[model samples]
Target: MNQDKRQILAQYEKSMTWVESLADVTEEQWRTPIEVGKWSVAEVIGHLIPWDEFVVSKRIPLLFTEDSLPKAPNVQEMNANAANSSRLQSKEETIGKFLNGRHQLIDALHHLTDEQWQHSFHIGESELTLYRYFSGLVEHDWHHFLQIEKVLK
Candidate 1:
Protein backbone atom coordinates (compact mmCIF):
# COMPACT_ATOMS: atom_id res chain seq x y z
CA MET A 1 0.00 0.00 0.00
CA ASN A 2 2.95 2.31 0.64
CA GLN A 3 5.10 3.77 -2.15
CA ASP A 4 7.80 1.10 -1.99
CA LYS A 5 5.30 -1.75 -1.92
CA ARG A 6 3.38 -0.09 -4.71
CA GLN A 7 6.53 0.13 -6.81
CA ILE A 8 7.39 -3.51 -6.19
CA LEU A 9 3.87 -4.60 -7.08
CA ALA A 10 3.91 -2.54 -10.25
CA GLN A 11 7.20 -4.06 -11.34
CA TYR A 12 5.87 -7.51 -10.51
CA GLU A 13 2.81 -6.85 -12.64
CA LYS A 14 5.05 -5.94 -15.55
CA SER A 15 7.04 -9.13 -14.97
CA MET A 16 3.83 -11.13 -14.97
CA THR A 17 2.80 -9.61 -18.29
CA TRP A 18 6.15 -10.42 -19.86
CA VAL A 19 6.01 -14.01 -18.63
CA GLU A 20 2.39 -14.56 -19.53
CA SER A 21 3.07 -13.36 -23.06
CA LEU A 22 5.27 -16.42 -23.44
CA ALA A 23 2.22 -18.61 -22.99
CA ASP A 24 1.66 -18.39 -26.69
CA VAL A 25 5.16 -19.52 -27.55
CA THR A 26 5.46 -22.91 -29.15
CA GLU A 27 6.66 -25.89 -27.12
CA GLU A 28 9.80 -26.05 -29.24
CA GLN A 29 10.41 -22.39 -28.53
CA TRP A 30 10.01 -22.96 -24.82
CA ARG A 31 12.63 -25.69 -25.04
CA THR A 32 15.02 -23.53 -27.05
CA PRO A 33 18.10 -22.38 -25.18
CA ILE A 34 18.36 -18.70 -24.46
CA GLU A 35 21.56 -16.60 -24.56
CA VAL A 36 22.12 -17.35 -20.87
CA GLY A 37 23.58 -20.57 -22.35
CA LYS A 38 22.16 -23.46 -20.34
CA TRP A 39 18.71 -22.10 -19.61
CA SER A 40 15.74 -22.75 -21.83
CA VAL A 41 12.54 -20.80 -21.41
CA ALA A 42 11.23 -23.68 -19.34
CA GLU A 43 14.35 -23.72 -17.20
CA VAL A 44 14.20 -19.96 -16.79
CA ILE A 45 10.63 -20.23 -15.55
CA GLY A 46 11.76 -23.10 -13.33
CA HIS A 47 14.45 -20.87 -11.86
CA LEU A 48 12.02 -18.04 -11.13
CA ILE A 49 9.71 -20.20 -9.04
CA PRO A 50 12.39 -20.93 -6.47
CA TRP A 51 13.33 -17.25 -6.22
CA ASP A 52 9.79 -16.23 -5.32
CA GLU A 53 9.44 -19.25 -3.07
CA PHE A 54 12.71 -18.40 -1.33
CA VAL A 55 11.69 -14.82 -0.70
CA VAL A 56 8.15 -15.62 0.41
CA SER A 57 8.86 -18.80 2.35
CA LYS A 58 12.45 -18.76 3.56
CA ARG A 59 14.12 -15.35 3.37
CA ILE A 60 11.22 -13.32 4.78
CA PRO A 61 10.91 -15.61 7.79
CA LEU A 62 14.65 -15.50 8.33
CA LEU A 63 14.53 -11.73 8.35
CA PHE A 64 12.09 -11.82 11.25
CA THR A 65 14.10 -14.31 13.32
CA GLU A 66 17.73 -13.92 12.32
CA ASP A 67 19.88 -10.88 12.87
CA SER A 68 20.94 -10.83 9.22
CA LEU A 69 20.15 -12.40 5.90
CA PRO A 70 22.11 -15.40 4.78
CA LYS A 71 25.17 -14.83 2.63
CA ALA A 72 24.10 -14.62 -0.99
CA PRO A 73 25.53 -17.26 -3.25
CA ASN A 74 27.32 -16.41 -6.47
CA VAL A 75 25.13 -16.22 -9.59
CA GLN A 76 26.92 -19.14 -11.21
CA GLU A 77 26.45 -21.22 -8.09
CA MET A 78 22.78 -20.36 -8.00
CA ASN A 79 22.40 -21.27 -11.67
CA ALA A 80 24.20 -24.56 -11.07
CA ASN A 81 21.88 -25.29 -8.18
CA ALA A 82 18.85 -24.55 -10.30
CA ALA A 83 20.18 -26.77 -13.08
CA ASN A 84 20.65 -29.62 -10.63
CA SER A 85 17.25 -29.23 -9.02
CA SER A 86 15.17 -32.36 -9.62
CA ARG A 87 12.08 -30.35 -8.83
CA LEU A 88 12.35 -28.46 -12.12
CA GLN A 89 9.19 -29.43 -13.90
CA SER A 90 8.07 -29.64 -17.54
CA LYS A 91 7.24 -26.58 -19.61
CA GLU A 92 3.55 -26.61 -18.76
CA GLU A 93 4.21 -27.48 -15.14
CA THR A 94 6.89 -24.81 -14.80
CA ILE A 95 4.60 -22.20 -16.31
CA GLY A 96 1.83 -23.05 -13.86
CA LYS A 97 4.27 -23.05 -10.95
CA PHE A 98 5.66 -19.69 -12.00
CA LEU A 99 2.20 -18.19 -12.18
CA ASN A 100 1.31 -19.47 -8.74
CA GLY A 101 4.61 -18.43 -7.18
CA ARG A 102 4.34 -14.96 -8.73
CA HIS A 103 0.86 -14.49 -7.28
CA GLN A 104 2.08 -15.53 -3.86
CA LEU A 105 4.92 -13.02 -4.09
CA ILE A 106 2.52 -10.25 -5.05
CA ASP A 107 0.15 -11.09 -2.20
CA ALA A 108 2.99 -11.21 0.33
CA LEU A 109 4.35 -7.87 -0.84
CA HIS A 110 0.91 -6.30 -0.61
CA HIS A 111 0.57 -7.29 3.03
CA LEU A 112 3.95 -5.97 4.25
CA THR A 113 3.96 -2.80 6.34
CA ASP A 114 5.95 0.29 5.28
CA GLU A 115 8.46 -0.47 8.04
CA GLN A 116 8.84 -4.02 6.80
CA TRP A 117 9.35 -2.71 3.28
CA GLN A 118 12.37 -0.76 4.55
CA HIS A 119 13.80 -3.62 6.63
CA SER A 120 17.43 -4.34 5.81
CA PHE A 121 18.97 -7.68 4.99
CA HIS A 122 22.60 -8.59 4.54
CA ILE A 123 23.50 -10.39 1.34
CA GLY A 124 27.13 -11.41 1.46
CA GLU A 125 28.97 -8.33 2.79
CA SER A 126 26.35 -5.93 1.44
CA GLU A 127 23.23 -4.67 3.15
CA LEU A 128 20.07 -4.32 1.06
CA THR A 129 16.64 -3.01 1.83
CA LEU A 130 13.53 -4.96 0.84
CA TYR A 131 13.12 -2.36 -1.90
CA ARG A 132 16.54 -3.16 -3.33
CA TYR A 133 15.78 -6.86 -3.20
CA PHE A 134 12.56 -6.30 -5.08
CA SER A 135 14.35 -4.13 -7.61
CA GLY A 136 16.90 -6.88 -8.07
CA LEU A 137 14.08 -9.28 -8.81
CA VAL A 138 12.72 -6.95 -11.47
CA GLU A 139 16.12 -6.54 -13.05
CA HIS A 140 16.65 -10.28 -13.08
CA ASP A 141 13.26 -10.90 -14.66
CA TRP A 142 13.87 -8.40 -17.44
CA HIS A 143 17.34 -9.80 -18.09
CA HIS A 144 16.00 -13.30 -18.54
CA PHE A 145 12.94 -12.13 -20.40
CA LEU A 146 15.06 -10.35 -22.98
CA GLN A 147 17.19 -13.46 -23.40
CA ILE A 148 14.10 -15.58 -23.90
CA GLU A 149 12.65 -13.12 -26.36
CA LYS A 150 15.84 -13.19 -28.40
CA VAL A 151 15.88 -16.97 -28.49
CA LEU A 152 12.25 -17.09 -29.53
CA LYS A 153 12.99 -14.74 -32.38
Candidate 2:
Protein backbone atom coordinates (compact mmCIF):
# COMPACT_ATOMS: atom_id res chain seq x y z
CA MET A 1 0.00 0.00 0.00
CA ASN A 2 1.06 3.59 -0.58
CA GLN A 3 1.86 5.79 2.40
CA ASP A 4 -1.52 7.56 2.27
CA LYS A 5 -3.46 4.31 2.10
CA ARG A 6 -1.38 2.85 4.91
CA GLN A 7 -2.14 5.94 7.01
CA ILE A 8 -5.86 5.63 6.41
CA LEU A 9 -5.81 1.93 7.33
CA ALA A 10 -3.78 2.69 10.43
CA GLN A 11 -6.28 5.36 11.47
CA TYR A 12 -9.16 2.93 11.10
CA GLU A 13 -7.32 0.28 13.06
CA LYS A 14 -6.36 2.77 15.74
CA SER A 15 -9.97 3.79 16.10
CA MET A 16 -10.90 0.27 17.23
CA THR A 17 -8.22 0.43 19.89
CA TRP A 18 -9.27 3.90 21.01
CA VAL A 19 -12.90 2.89 21.35
CA GLU A 20 -12.07 -0.37 23.07
CA SER A 21 -10.17 1.64 25.66
CA LEU A 22 -13.41 3.42 26.43
CA ALA A 23 -14.69 0.19 27.97
CA ASP A 24 -13.61 1.56 31.33
CA VAL A 25 -15.51 4.83 31.07
CA THR A 26 -18.25 5.31 33.61
CA GLU A 27 -21.85 5.01 32.44
CA GLU A 28 -22.66 8.56 33.45
CA GLN A 29 -19.66 9.90 31.53
CA TRP A 30 -20.58 7.96 28.44
CA ARG A 31 -24.11 9.31 28.58
CA THR A 32 -23.17 12.93 29.17
CA PRO A 33 -23.45 15.27 26.20
CA ILE A 34 -20.14 16.32 24.63
CA GLU A 35 -21.51 19.85 24.42
CA VAL A 36 -24.49 21.87 25.63
CA GLY A 37 -26.80 20.60 22.88
CA LYS A 38 -24.90 18.03 20.87
CA TRP A 39 -24.61 14.25 20.87
CA SER A 40 -23.35 12.42 23.92
CA VAL A 41 -20.24 10.28 23.60
CA ALA A 42 -22.29 7.16 23.05
CA GLU A 43 -24.50 8.87 20.49
CA VAL A 44 -21.49 10.19 18.66
CA ILE A 45 -20.03 6.72 18.46
CA GLY A 46 -23.35 5.17 17.54
CA HIS A 47 -23.86 7.54 14.62
CA LEU A 48 -20.66 6.24 13.06
CA ILE A 49 -21.99 2.70 12.73
CA PRO A 50 -24.54 3.35 9.99
CA TRP A 51 -22.23 5.58 8.02
CA ASP A 52 -19.59 2.86 7.99
CA GLU A 53 -22.15 0.23 7.12
CA PHE A 54 -23.40 2.40 4.28
CA VAL A 55 -19.94 2.76 2.86
CA VAL A 56 -19.22 -0.96 3.05
CA SER A 57 -22.51 -2.01 1.51
CA LYS A 58 -23.55 0.89 -0.70
CA ARG A 59 -20.50 2.85 -1.75
CA ILE A 60 -17.56 0.46 -2.07
CA PRO A 61 -19.10 -2.01 -4.48
CA LEU A 62 -20.25 0.59 -6.99
CA LEU A 63 -17.25 2.88 -6.87
CA PHE A 64 -15.48 1.46 -9.93
CA THR A 65 -18.51 -0.21 -11.43
CA GLU A 66 -20.91 1.04 -14.10
CA ASP A 67 -23.86 1.16 -11.72
CA SER A 68 -24.81 4.56 -10.32
CA LEU A 69 -24.33 4.88 -6.61
CA PRO A 70 -27.26 4.48 -4.32
CA LYS A 71 -28.98 7.56 -2.98
CA ALA A 72 -27.79 8.74 0.40
CA PRO A 73 -29.85 7.94 3.47
CA ASN A 74 -32.11 10.40 5.25
CA VAL A 75 -29.52 12.01 7.46
CA GLN A 76 -31.85 13.38 10.08
CA GLU A 77 -33.77 10.17 10.54
CA MET A 78 -30.67 8.01 10.50
CA ASN A 79 -28.83 10.11 13.05
CA ALA A 80 -31.86 10.49 15.29
CA ASN A 81 -32.41 6.75 15.28
CA ALA A 82 -28.78 5.99 16.06
CA ALA A 83 -28.72 8.52 18.90
CA ASN A 84 -31.90 7.13 20.31
CA SER A 85 -30.44 3.61 20.12
CA SER A 86 -27.37 4.72 22.04
CA ARG A 87 -29.56 6.23 24.71
CA LEU A 88 -31.45 2.97 25.17
CA GLN A 89 -28.56 0.52 24.86
CA SER A 90 -25.81 -0.19 27.33
CA LYS A 91 -22.42 1.39 26.71
CA GLU A 92 -20.97 -2.04 25.88
CA GLU A 93 -23.66 -2.64 23.27
CA THR A 94 -23.13 0.71 21.61
CA ILE A 95 -19.41 0.17 21.43
CA GLY A 96 -19.86 -3.35 20.13
CA LYS A 97 -22.05 -2.15 17.27
CA PHE A 98 -19.61 0.59 16.41
CA LEU A 99 -16.72 -1.86 16.36
CA ASN A 100 -18.65 -4.28 14.19
CA GLY A 101 -19.59 -1.69 11.58
CA ARG A 102 -16.10 -0.23 11.56
CA HIS A 103 -14.54 -3.68 11.18
CA GLN A 104 -16.73 -4.39 8.16
CA LEU A 105 -15.74 -1.07 6.62
CA ILE A 106 -12.06 -1.60 7.25
CA ASP A 107 -12.16 -5.11 5.82
CA ALA A 108 -13.88 -3.86 2.68
CA LEU A 109 -11.40 -1.05 2.27
CA HIS A 110 -8.47 -3.43 2.63
CA HIS A 111 -9.66 -5.40 -0.42
CA LEU A 112 -9.58 -2.46 -2.83
CA THR A 113 -6.84 -2.32 -5.47
CA ASP A 114 -4.16 0.35 -5.25
CA GLU A 115 -5.45 1.88 -8.48
CA GLN A 116 -8.92 2.21 -6.95
CA TRP A 117 -7.46 4.49 -4.31
CA GLN A 118 -6.78 7.14 -6.94
CA HIS A 119 -9.92 6.48 -9.02
CA SER A 120 -12.67 9.08 -9.13
CA PHE A 121 -16.28 8.16 -8.53
CA HIS A 122 -19.62 9.95 -8.82
CA ILE A 123 -21.64 10.70 -5.74
CA GLY A 124 -24.79 12.08 -7.27
CA GLU A 125 -23.08 14.69 -9.43
CA SER A 126 -19.91 15.34 -7.48
CA GLU A 127 -16.80 13.31 -8.21
CA LEU A 128 -14.26 12.34 -5.56
CA THR A 129 -11.25 10.08 -5.44
CA LEU A 130 -11.37 7.14 -3.02
CA TYR A 131 -8.47 8.59 -1.07
CA ARG A 132 -10.17 11.97 -0.84
CA TYR A 133 -13.44 10.38 0.26
CA PHE A 134 -11.82 8.34 3.02
CA SER A 135 -9.73 11.33 4.02
CA GLY A 136 -12.91 13.31 4.58
CA LEU A 137 -14.28 10.54 6.76
CA VAL A 138 -11.10 10.52 8.80
CA GLU A 139 -11.44 14.27 9.29
CA HIS A 140 -15.02 13.75 10.42
CA ASP A 141 -13.84 11.15 12.93
CA TRP A 142 -11.17 13.48 14.30
CA HIS A 143 -13.70 16.29 14.64
CA HIS A 144 -15.93 14.12 16.86
CA PHE A 145 -12.94 12.66 18.72
CA LEU A 146 -11.88 16.19 19.65
CA GLN A 147 -15.37 17.03 20.83
CA ILE A 148 -15.51 13.89 22.99
CA GLU A 149 -11.98 14.41 24.30
CA LYS A 150 -12.83 17.98 25.30
CA VAL A 151 -15.83 16.84 27.29
CA LEU A 152 -13.96 13.91 28.83
CA LYS A 153 -11.16 16.15 29.94
Candidate 3:
Protein backbone atom coordinates (compact mmCIF):
# COMPACT_ATOMS: atom_id res chain seq x y z
CA MET A 1 0.00 0.00 0.00
CA ASN A 2 0.98 3.63 -0.59
CA GLN A 3 1.81 6.08 2.19
CA ASP A 4 -1.58 7.79 2.30
CA LYS A 5 -3.47 4.50 2.38
CA ARG A 6 -1.12 3.17 5.01
CA GLN A 7 -1.62 6.18 7.21
CA ILE A 8 -5.39 6.17 6.73
CA LEU A 9 -5.67 2.48 7.56
CA ALA A 10 -3.33 2.81 10.51
CA GLN A 11 -5.35 5.64 12.00
CA TYR A 12 -8.61 3.74 11.58
CA GLU A 13 -7.13 0.66 13.20
CA LYS A 14 -5.78 2.72 16.07
CA SER A 15 -9.23 4.22 16.70
CA MET A 16 -10.95 0.86 16.57
CA THR A 17 -8.48 -0.59 19.02
CA TRP A 18 -9.25 2.21 21.44
CA VAL A 19 -12.94 1.57 21.09
CA GLU A 20 -12.38 -2.08 21.83
CA SER A 21 -10.64 -1.14 25.05
CA LEU A 22 -13.80 0.59 26.26
CA ALA A 23 -15.89 -2.57 25.98
CA ASP A 24 -15.93 -3.25 29.71
CA VAL A 25 -16.33 0.24 31.16
CA THR A 26 -19.07 0.63 33.75
CA GLU A 27 -21.99 3.00 33.24
CA GLU A 28 -20.82 5.30 36.03
CA GLN A 29 -17.34 5.34 34.60
CA TRP A 30 -18.65 6.31 31.17
CA ARG A 31 -20.70 9.09 32.71
CA THR A 32 -18.03 10.46 35.03
CA PRO A 33 -16.82 13.96 34.22
CA ILE A 34 -13.25 14.09 32.93
CA GLU A 35 -12.65 17.31 34.88
CA VAL A 36 -14.45 19.75 37.14
CA GLY A 37 -15.96 21.67 34.23
CA LYS A 38 -15.42 19.27 31.36
CA TRP A 39 -17.47 16.78 29.37
CA SER A 40 -17.90 13.13 30.21
CA VAL A 41 -16.40 10.42 28.00
CA ALA A 42 -19.77 9.90 26.38
CA GLU A 43 -20.06 13.61 25.65
CA VAL A 44 -16.68 13.70 23.98
CA ILE A 45 -17.62 10.76 21.79
CA GLY A 46 -20.84 12.59 21.13
CA HIS A 47 -18.88 15.58 19.85
CA LEU A 48 -16.88 13.44 17.43
CA ILE A 49 -19.62 11.46 15.65
CA PRO A 50 -21.24 14.34 13.80
CA TRP A 51 -17.97 15.39 12.21
CA ASP A 52 -17.27 11.82 11.16
CA GLU A 53 -20.77 11.59 9.70
CA PHE A 54 -20.22 14.87 7.86
CA VAL A 55 -16.98 13.59 6.37
CA VAL A 56 -18.58 10.35 5.19
CA SER A 57 -21.82 11.80 3.82
CA LYS A 58 -20.76 15.28 2.73
CA ARG A 59 -17.12 16.35 2.99
CA ILE A 60 -15.47 13.43 1.21
CA PRO A 61 -18.02 13.48 -1.59
CA LEU A 62 -17.59 17.24 -1.91
CA LEU A 63 -13.86 16.80 -2.13
CA PHE A 64 -14.41 14.56 -5.17
CA THR A 65 -16.49 17.18 -6.97
CA GLU A 66 -15.57 20.41 -8.76
CA ASP A 67 -17.97 22.55 -6.74
CA SER A 68 -16.64 25.12 -4.32
CA LEU A 69 -16.15 23.86 -0.80
CA PRO A 70 -18.70 24.92 1.74
CA LYS A 71 -18.03 27.18 4.69
CA ALA A 72 -17.20 25.58 8.03
CA PRO A 73 -19.92 25.07 10.61
CA ASN A 74 -19.87 26.92 13.92
CA VAL A 75 -17.89 24.62 16.20
CA GLN A 76 -19.56 25.86 19.36
CA GLU A 77 -23.00 25.38 17.84
CA MET A 78 -22.10 21.95 16.59
CA ASN A 79 -20.73 20.86 19.93
CA ALA A 80 -23.76 22.22 21.74
CA ASN A 81 -26.07 20.40 19.38
CA ALA A 82 -24.17 17.15 19.80
CA ALA A 83 -24.13 17.39 23.55
CA ASN A 84 -27.80 18.25 23.73
CA SER A 85 -28.86 15.45 21.44
CA SER A 86 -26.52 12.88 22.89
CA ARG A 87 -27.71 13.48 26.44
CA LEU A 88 -30.83 11.50 25.53
CA GLN A 89 -28.72 8.61 24.33
CA SER A 90 -27.20 5.79 26.36
CA LYS A 91 -23.44 5.53 26.68
CA GLU A 92 -23.53 2.39 24.56
CA GLU A 93 -25.39 4.24 21.83
CA THR A 94 -22.89 7.08 21.80
CA ILE A 95 -19.97 4.67 21.59
CA GLY A 96 -21.70 2.74 18.84
CA LYS A 97 -22.16 5.94 16.85
CA PHE A 98 -18.47 6.70 17.22
CA LEU A 99 -17.52 3.23 16.01
CA ASN A 100 -20.03 3.27 13.18
CA GLY A 101 -19.07 6.75 12.09
CA ARG A 102 -15.40 5.85 11.87
CA HIS A 103 -16.16 2.63 10.03
CA GLN A 104 -18.25 4.44 7.45
CA LEU A 105 -15.62 7.15 6.99
CA ILE A 106 -12.76 4.69 6.56
CA ASP A 107 -14.82 2.54 4.19
CA ALA A 108 -15.73 5.60 2.13
CA LEU A 109 -12.12 6.70 1.79
CA HIS A 110 -10.91 3.18 1.05
CA HIS A 111 -12.75 3.40 -2.27
CA LEU A 112 -10.48 6.20 -3.49
CA THR A 113 -7.69 5.52 -5.91
CA ASP A 114 -4.13 6.61 -5.16
CA GLU A 115 -4.73 9.70 -7.28
CA GLN A 116 -7.75 10.53 -5.19
CA TRP A 117 -5.71 10.03 -2.06
CA GLN A 118 -3.31 12.65 -3.41
CA HIS A 119 -6.15 15.00 -4.35
CA SER A 120 -5.92 18.50 -2.91
CA PHE A 121 -8.67 20.86 -1.92
CA HIS A 122 -7.97 24.55 -1.80
CA ILE A 123 -9.63 26.24 1.13
CA GLY A 124 -9.09 29.91 1.84
CA GLU A 125 -5.35 30.53 1.46
CA SER A 126 -4.17 26.96 1.80
CA GLU A 127 -4.31 23.71 -0.13
CA LEU A 128 -4.82 20.55 1.94
CA THR A 129 -4.12 16.95 1.02
CA LEU A 130 -6.48 14.12 1.94
CA TYR A 131 -3.75 12.67 4.11
CA ARG A 132 -3.29 15.88 6.09
CA TYR A 133 -7.03 16.38 6.52
CA PHE A 134 -7.64 12.91 7.88
CA SER A 135 -4.45 12.83 9.90
CA GLY A 136 -5.75 15.92 11.70
CA LEU A 137 -8.81 13.88 12.57
CA VAL A 138 -6.61 11.20 14.07
CA GLU A 139 -5.10 13.92 16.24
CA HIS A 140 -8.58 15.18 17.11
CA ASP A 141 -9.48 11.67 18.30
CA TRP A 142 -6.42 11.61 20.53
CA HIS A 143 -7.24 15.00 22.02
CA HIS A 144 -10.52 13.73 23.49
CA PHE A 145 -9.04 10.29 24.12
CA LEU A 146 -6.52 11.71 26.56
CA GLN A 147 -9.39 13.21 28.54
CA ILE A 148 -11.02 9.81 28.83
CA GLU A 149 -7.74 8.28 29.94
CA LYS A 150 -6.82 11.00 32.41
CA VAL A 151 -10.12 10.89 34.24
CA LEU A 152 -10.54 7.13 34.10
CA LYS A 153 -7.07 6.45 35.46
Candidate 4:
Protein backbone atom coordinates (compact mmCIF):
# COMPACT_ATOMS: atom_id res chain seq x y z
CA MET A 1 0.00 0.00 0.00
CA ASN A 2 0.98 3.64 -0.46
CA GLN A 3 2.10 5.95 2.36
CA ASP A 4 -1.33 7.57 2.63
CA LYS A 5 -3.08 4.21 2.88
CA ARG A 6 -0.60 3.08 5.50
CA GLN A 7 -1.28 6.21 7.50
CA ILE A 8 -5.04 5.74 7.16
CA LEU A 9 -4.88 2.16 8.43
CA ALA A 10 -2.60 3.17 11.27
CA GLN A 11 -5.09 5.79 12.44
CA TYR A 12 -7.88 3.22 12.56
CA GLU A 13 -5.69 0.97 14.67
CA LYS A 14 -4.74 3.84 16.91
CA SER A 15 -8.34 4.88 17.49
CA MET A 16 -9.45 1.39 18.52
CA THR A 17 -6.41 0.63 20.66
CA TRP A 18 -6.56 4.00 22.39
CA VAL A 19 -10.16 3.38 23.42
CA GLU A 20 -9.40 -0.15 24.53
CA SER A 21 -6.66 1.23 26.75
CA LEU A 22 -9.34 3.00 28.76
CA ALA A 23 -11.29 -0.20 29.46
CA ASP A 24 -10.19 -0.16 33.07
CA VAL A 25 -11.63 3.28 33.86
CA THR A 26 -13.91 3.22 36.85
CA GLU A 27 -17.61 4.02 36.45
CA GLU A 28 -17.30 7.18 38.51
CA GLN A 29 -14.45 8.42 36.35
CA TRP A 30 -16.43 7.71 33.20
CA ARG A 31 -19.13 10.19 34.31
CA THR A 32 -16.83 12.89 35.62
CA PRO A 33 -16.13 15.76 33.30
CA ILE A 34 -12.55 16.51 32.34
CA GLU A 35 -13.39 20.20 32.82
CA VAL A 36 -16.34 22.39 33.62
CA GLY A 37 -19.11 22.31 30.94
CA LYS A 38 -17.13 19.81 28.87
CA TRP A 39 -18.16 16.32 27.90
CA SER A 40 -17.58 13.52 30.37
CA VAL A 41 -15.38 10.63 29.27
CA ALA A 42 -18.42 8.59 28.31
CA GLU A 43 -20.02 11.48 26.49
CA VAL A 44 -16.88 12.12 24.50
CA ILE A 45 -16.74 8.53 23.30
CA GLY A 46 -20.45 8.70 22.55
CA HIS A 47 -19.81 11.71 20.36
CA LEU A 48 -17.05 9.89 18.50
CA ILE A 49 -19.41 7.06 17.54
CA PRO A 50 -21.58 9.13 15.20
CA TRP A 51 -18.63 10.52 13.29
CA ASP A 52 -17.54 7.01 12.45
CA GLU A 53 -21.02 6.12 11.26
CA PHE A 54 -21.12 9.29 9.21
CA VAL A 55 -17.90 8.36 7.49
CA VAL A 56 -19.06 4.84 6.74
CA SER A 57 -22.63 5.61 5.68
CA LYS A 58 -22.25 9.05 4.14
CA ARG A 59 -18.70 10.19 3.45
CA ILE A 60 -17.20 6.98 2.10
CA PRO A 61 -20.13 6.14 -0.12
CA LEU A 62 -20.28 9.65 -1.50
CA LEU A 63 -16.87 9.09 -3.06
CA PHE A 64 -18.10 6.37 -5.38
CA THR A 65 -21.17 8.25 -6.53
CA GLU A 66 -22.24 11.48 -8.18
CA ASP A 67 -24.61 12.61 -5.45
CA SER A 68 -23.85 15.73 -3.45
CA LEU A 69 -22.64 15.19 0.07
CA PRO A 70 -25.07 15.85 2.88
CA LYS A 71 -24.79 19.00 4.90
CA ALA A 72 -22.63 18.74 8.00
CA PRO A 73 -24.29 17.62 11.24
CA ASN A 74 -25.13 20.08 13.97
CA VAL A 75 -22.20 19.55 16.27
CA GLN A 76 -23.36 21.29 19.43
CA GLU A 77 -26.75 19.65 19.49
CA MET A 78 -25.38 16.32 18.41
CA ASN A 79 -22.78 16.41 21.15
CA ALA A 80 -25.36 17.34 23.72
CA ASN A 81 -27.70 14.60 22.62
CA ALA A 82 -25.07 11.94 22.44
CA ALA A 83 -23.86 12.74 25.91
CA ASN A 84 -27.35 12.96 27.35
CA SER A 85 -28.43 9.78 25.67
CA SER A 86 -25.40 7.87 26.79
CA ARG A 87 -25.40 9.24 30.32
CA LEU A 88 -27.58 6.41 31.60
CA GLN A 89 -25.68 3.66 29.86
CA SER A 90 -23.43 1.28 31.74
CA LYS A 91 -19.74 1.66 30.96
CA GLU A 92 -19.82 -1.56 28.99
CA GLU A 93 -22.79 -0.46 26.90
CA THR A 94 -21.20 2.87 26.03
CA ILE A 95 -17.93 1.23 25.10
CA GLY A 96 -19.69 -1.45 23.09
CA LYS A 97 -21.52 1.13 21.00
CA PHE A 98 -18.27 2.94 20.37
CA LEU A 99 -16.43 -0.19 19.34
CA ASN A 100 -19.25 -1.31 17.05
CA GLY A 101 -19.25 2.00 15.21
CA ARG A 102 -15.50 2.12 14.93
CA HIS A 103 -15.30 -1.40 13.54
CA GLN A 104 -18.08 -0.64 11.07
CA LEU A 105 -16.19 2.38 9.80
CA ILE A 106 -12.93 0.49 9.53
CA ASP A 107 -14.66 -2.32 7.67
CA ALA A 108 -16.28 0.10 5.22
CA LEU A 109 -12.94 1.74 4.61
CA HIS A 110 -11.13 -1.52 3.88
CA HIS A 111 -13.21 -2.16 0.76
CA LEU A 112 -12.10 0.99 -1.03
CA THR A 113 -10.06 0.68 -4.17
CA ASP A 114 -6.63 2.32 -4.33
CA GLU A 115 -8.09 5.04 -6.51
CA GLN A 116 -10.65 5.83 -3.81
CA TRP A 117 -7.87 6.77 -1.44
CA GLN A 118 -7.25 9.74 -3.70
CA HIS A 119 -10.98 10.36 -4.28
CA SER A 120 -12.03 13.96 -3.87
CA PHE A 121 -15.21 15.48 -2.49
CA HIS A 122 -16.33 18.94 -1.50
CA ILE A 123 -17.26 19.77 2.09
CA GLY A 124 -18.37 23.33 2.69
CA GLU A 125 -15.57 25.60 1.42
CA SER A 126 -13.02 22.89 0.72
CA GLU A 127 -12.34 20.08 -1.71
CA LEU A 128 -10.88 17.13 0.21
CA THR A 129 -9.72 13.60 -0.38
CA LEU A 130 -10.82 10.36 1.30
CA TYR A 131 -7.38 10.14 2.86
CA ARG A 132 -7.56 13.66 4.28
CA TYR A 133 -11.08 13.23 5.63
CA PHE A 134 -10.23 10.00 7.42
CA SER A 135 -6.97 11.44 8.74
CA GLY A 136 -8.92 14.29 10.25
CA LEU A 137 -10.96 11.73 12.19
CA VAL A 138 -7.72 10.24 13.51
CA GLU A 139 -6.80 13.66 14.79
CA HIS A 140 -10.28 13.96 16.23
CA ASP A 141 -9.82 10.65 18.05
CA TRP A 142 -6.52 11.82 19.55
CA HIS A 143 -8.08 15.09 20.62
CA HIS A 144 -10.74 13.23 22.64
CA PHE A 145 -8.24 10.67 23.92
CA LEU A 146 -6.21 13.53 25.34
CA GLN A 147 -9.29 14.98 26.98
CA ILE A 148 -10.16 11.61 28.53
CA GLU A 149 -6.62 11.40 29.88
CA LYS A 150 -6.89 14.83 31.44
CA VAL A 151 -10.16 13.80 33.05
CA LEU A 152 -8.45 10.74 34.48
CA LYS A 153 -5.69 12.94 35.85
**Leading candidate by TM-score:** 2
| CA RMSD of each candidate after superposition | 2.8, 0.9, 1.4, 1.4
Q: Estimate each model's TM-score.
A: 0.82, 0.96, 0.92, 0.92
lDDT of 3 by residue, 1-153 (tens): 568888887888788779767767888888787898888777887898888887787687788688877766888999988987667888778878888888888898788778887778876677899888888888888888988999889
Candidate 3 lDDT for residue 43: 82
Model 3 clashing-pair count = 0
Q: Can you tell me which runs of candidate 3 are displaced by over 4 Å? A: none
Pick by lDDT: which candidate is best? 2
- Encode model 1's per-residue lDDT on 88-133: one tens digit a residue: 4566666777788999989888777888876776776778888888
Return the TM-score for candidate 1, rounded to 2 decimals.
Answer: 0.82
Task: Compute the lDDT of residue 43 as modeled in candidate 2.
Answer: 96
Worst 10 residues of 3 by lDDT: 117-126
Residue pairs in steric clash, candidate 4?
none
lDDT of candidate 3 at residue 60, scale 0 to 100? 75
Q: Worst 10-residue stretch by lDDT in candidate 2?
A: 1-10
Q: Which regions in candidate 4 have their CA more than 4 angstroms from the true location?
A: none
- lDDT by residue for model 2 over 80-114, one digit each (tens)? 99999999999999999989988998899889988
- The window of 10 residues in a row where model 1 has the poorest summed lDDT is 83-92
What is the lDDT, from 0 to 100, of the residue 63 in candidate 2?
90
- In angstroms, the error of model 1 at 128 is 1.8
The RMSD (Cα, Å) of candidate 1 is 2.8
Instruction: Order the numbered candidates by lDDT, best leading.
Output: 2, 3, 4, 1
